[model samples]
Target chain A: MAGEVKFGILSCANIARTLISAMKLLPEVKIHAIASRSLDKVQSFAAANDVPKETKLYGSYEELLDDDEVDALYVPLPTGLHVEWVLKAAAKKKHILIEKPPAHTVKELDVMLEALQKNGLQYMDGTMWMHHPRTHKMEAVLHDSSTIGRICEVHSTFNYSAEVAYRRKGGLSADVRGNPNLDGLGALGDIGWYCVRGILWAYDYEMPKSVTAHPGASYNEKGVIVSCGATFVWEDGRTATFTTSFNTGHVMKLLVVGVNGSLENDDFVLPARADRAGFKVVSNTSWKDVLGGWNRTEDVQEVTLEIPQEAHMVREFARLVASIRDGSGAVEPRWAEISRKTQVLLDAVKESIENGLKTIDV
Target chain B: MAGEVKFGILSCANIARTLISAMKLLPEVKIHAIASRSLDKVQSFAAANDVPKETKLYGSYEELLDDDEVDALYVPLPTGLHVEWVLKAAAKKKHILIEKPPAHTVKELDVMLEALQKNGLQYMDGTMWMHHPRTHKMEAVLHDSSTIGRICEVHSTFNYSAEVAYRRKGGLSADVRGNPNLDGLGALGDIGWYCVRGILWAYDYEMPKSVTAHPGASYNEKGVIVSCGATFVWEDGRTATFTTSFNTGHVMKLLVVGVNGSLENDDFVLPARADRAGFKVVSNTSWKDVLGGWNRTEDVQEVTLEIPQEAHMVREFARLVASIRDGSGAVEPRWAEISRKTQVLLDAVKESIENGLKTIDV
Candidate 1:
């Protein structure tokens, strides 16, 4: 069941570039094929990467998933098209590691996953920051009673400029970043999802009973927020906040506050090279020594979670496949779980965007 | 008129400790007398800190202001009491340096200043941080044509535990810090005012044409805000935002973004002895330096903002008196200007707070 995972990337959106490069570093994986809306793009990508034999090219995603040899699919389409492709691929029995956010609405997200369950396919959202081992290290500090001493409060902001090259009119009059119908939440949905998802995931998805989202200072009052924030009132009385802006230059960081001290990491995601990212864990105690006891700080034992980038996607897909092959796994895919908890707040964000920061009764 | 300015200590509040300590270092100041609700309190302070030749201990502020020799009075009373005492002292023909948020209501603030003008007394609300010469130095970078560029946006936040403590029953009882009536806008009025005032001041009183604040988020939502944020829009399509929280832990910082570059100072008002407070100005050249020849890296110079402890207050008060004595000097105090602006927005804030973040028609 596991000599190596055969992975096939769908399309050549720039986001897949990092994961495709990451796959090259791992021997247990093979980038067997790629499909784009255009055959020329897929074939060119296959040749440019020196993809191994059996690196077939398909003109359409439907044609690609129909092949019995194709084990899984990665969906990184424009935000609007994601649900269509995800449901279609899931119906074909191909597992998925879809790009964020998998769908725009919670109900739409649910329908996509239910179809997946009806056909039995694996799914994972392209939330890569959590895959980094540092995320868990931060969580351990929060959960570890001995360290960080009773997590008092936490705050994080993931603000990046998505409109640097963004234009209302593209080669075909398409805007993957600007159009709200295509891109759910501008600043909030794109990268802000990470902050929302990160805090929610770190806190074990203790779903907030109520949430208030605000586009108080949004651009043009397009309510297509250049900056929007929300407060999540969790069941356990823990609170987390999310702040993001599509207009601001770039500053994506996370902070975990505790009574004893805090764990602050600005470089939330590690780059493929690892060295370029000063992805450090600034804590009061030596985290490396604490997580990796004596003699374990050596290079091999340093706990660098260099997992397959799409490999998490690939593996999550494979795990879904293996689970369906065995009749069980998580109740729903991690992607679905994440989408459900965050999407309502996201929808409330949509409502907040439209209705001006309302409280969503979750 | 040509000599050092004589001063009177009008109260024995803990907040006044710093300014009182600073008076010892400057020979250009004369501590004329002291007054308090309790004669014992003023007597104890006079003995402990060295009140000049034959200190006058008044049982009431009335007797203290009645003394003809006292040129200026320093009031560090509860936030709510500023208007009352300021009115009384101003009527007695004494220069007024009242504590921050000169009054809870804009109406009261207007009347308090009217009395000052009526009596020909200089007036300013005590905002010790503004007095710090470094604050002016930082402002210089924003104003300086050479270093920082055109100001586009600003993000500021000032929060700590003082909010929650104040909302409890009798929290401010006799303690000014905990009383909402005395505090005016609670967290927003207390700290957010600084960021708002700083930006507006830097922009030549760009009265935000409109403002939209978020619905209050608080554990105890009935009182003032535990956390609140607002977006201030000016007439010329410029914008700024400020957030203040009594619920969150300590962080008093400001970040100003400009067209070509940005400057950030986190510890703007830390005690004068605090390490590394001086502003760090970064230019388009900073990017160049990071790439190897970064823009002229102007290291954070150790700026001795002539306002140490309360020397800014003492010196400023002295300057106001000298102006009165010589028939010429800096007549209008910085506090009066800042207070007028504060009252304007604070008046707007009440509507902003009540109307679920709508901009008041100021």
Candidate 2:
């Protein structure tokens, strides 16, 4: 069904600039089109990101969806507008690579998933870290029982200082994250998405038995959550906790504790040093050495990537699309499974927050 | 009364060996006696650590207490034995420097406190890390609003791989932590004690309004806790979470987040490097640089100590005892306040765990 995978990016959102630029680096994919409601925005974004001259520019999302040249669509629209555009793109029989918080809610995501299934197209959320080589290496260490043993606990936090910019631009009403009509879930959808994904990923996407949101949540004038935290418990006694905020300095951390060892990385969402990514692993530590002295050693392992994580993400998505188009493989269900689990957890946290911090079953 | 502060060792517990050695290094303090029920144990402990020839040796704790030359007693005993011996030491009018878990419960601790008050004795717990100069330096950074701003959240953890040793020594009945009749509160009194103290210390001994213990604690055959975690919330919406265990590899970390910055260290309970102490401070971390680019810089500040932290703890206790004896100053109430708060929080966590993880008010 395919010769080369071509991507059509929907919306000229600022994030789309990075996505398009990363996609341009993948040999398996070509930038096929750029679409927006405003022709000027499409032209400017396409030109600014150095989208290939062969790439078409469409004034409307529907016009790009109707084009036969686009084998897949990358939707980086605002959360509130994702359902409509994602569904339209999926209905056009294009494989979908959608931005995080693929939709505002699980119900909206379900509709998009159904369209992708009915049209026989592939789908994966654009979580760049997942495709990083460092991530894979860390995963190996975590699952290696001899080194890490069974995972006992995990703690992840994703926070950023975004409020100052919102205030400088005008006020809460003018802020996309602060506006209830735009990104209604605010920090929960924006930053908490990564946190929930991290916890689920650590446990191989095993759903938690229950999730209890911690009581206090900071909200904007529009009544959207800007900061929150939660604790989760699995059936077999494993536990995970996470905090997400827009009120603190930027910090992205993930710590996984095991019986024999632990893995920790502060810049889990984004590599700390862009050229190389690293994580610390300390295994089989003892207060006293076998020869009778204290021994404390930790190995900091780094994985250098020729391509940045964002580009690796684009390459992986392109490869998956290529496989499906060439009748080589079926869409990977793991991606959708984790994405749904993340939303389920997010929904439970929101539910717990709304209902006086009750424990909600995942 | 204060020519040189004299200290009596209550028992030849493994920890006493370290405390006595630290005490020997302090010129202002004299090791007056070493005591244990077994004469062989006391003699070997005293000689192995090179107690001075003038230091008295006692075959029983009672003989040590009766020694008129010993001005103070260092009680490094099991949790269940603390209340009985602490009250006994106080009744003899000896100033006290006790190890962690001063008593099994807060009520027991209150009785010991009453004894100290009745006997006009100076008291301090052997929480060595508290006496480290590095701790005070980090405290300054946390309290400095211009740099770190207001403390909003804290995450502290203290865990060690003690299970292998426990098993090697022959299972639950032989393990003090596993025997409910000995260290009754188990991991809560052992590791969780330090985690709770770290959180309380970070907030200047302010008690949390509520504490909810996380479920799924691992226990030995005797049903004593081995691993557990909890979430705490203050009246002002400041939050803290902690996890403590004997099942995992050693990890002692404390991360304090502020509005403008954060202070983090992995060796809060024990310095990672004994010769020097360090903590990372990331202050005034705006999302962008002053010139408008991403800027993330963390400064590692280290404070070198002429004496180890344990020596500093002994020296501090001796100073307090000296002040009491020479009419220089009364005992510092601050140490007792923080110790009591730590016990209260520990009691609350135990209560929550016993009550099936109910949210308990402190």
On TM-score, the leading prediction is 2
**lDDT for each candidate structure:** 0.62, 0.82
Task: Indicate which candidate wins on lDDT.
Answer: 2
* Model 2, C-alpha of B148: deviation from truth (Å): 2.8
Clashes of each: 6, 0
Model 2: lDDT of residue A122? 85
**What are the per-residue Cα lDDT tens digits for candidate 2 across B1-362?**
25789989898877887787687778899888889998898888878877789888889999998988889999888888988888888888999898888877899988998889888898888788899999999888877788767787888888877766567787545777778877887888887898899898899888889998776677777888888888898897788888888777777889888777788888787776667888998765654311112346789999987778888898888888988888998877777778888989998988887886788987
Clashing pairs in 2: none
Residues A20-111, candidate 2, lDDT per residue (tens digit)?
Answer: 76776677788888899989988887777777898899999999999988988888877888888878887788998888887767988888
Per-residue CA lDDT of model 1 for B30-60, tens digit only, reads: 6666778988888787677655555677878
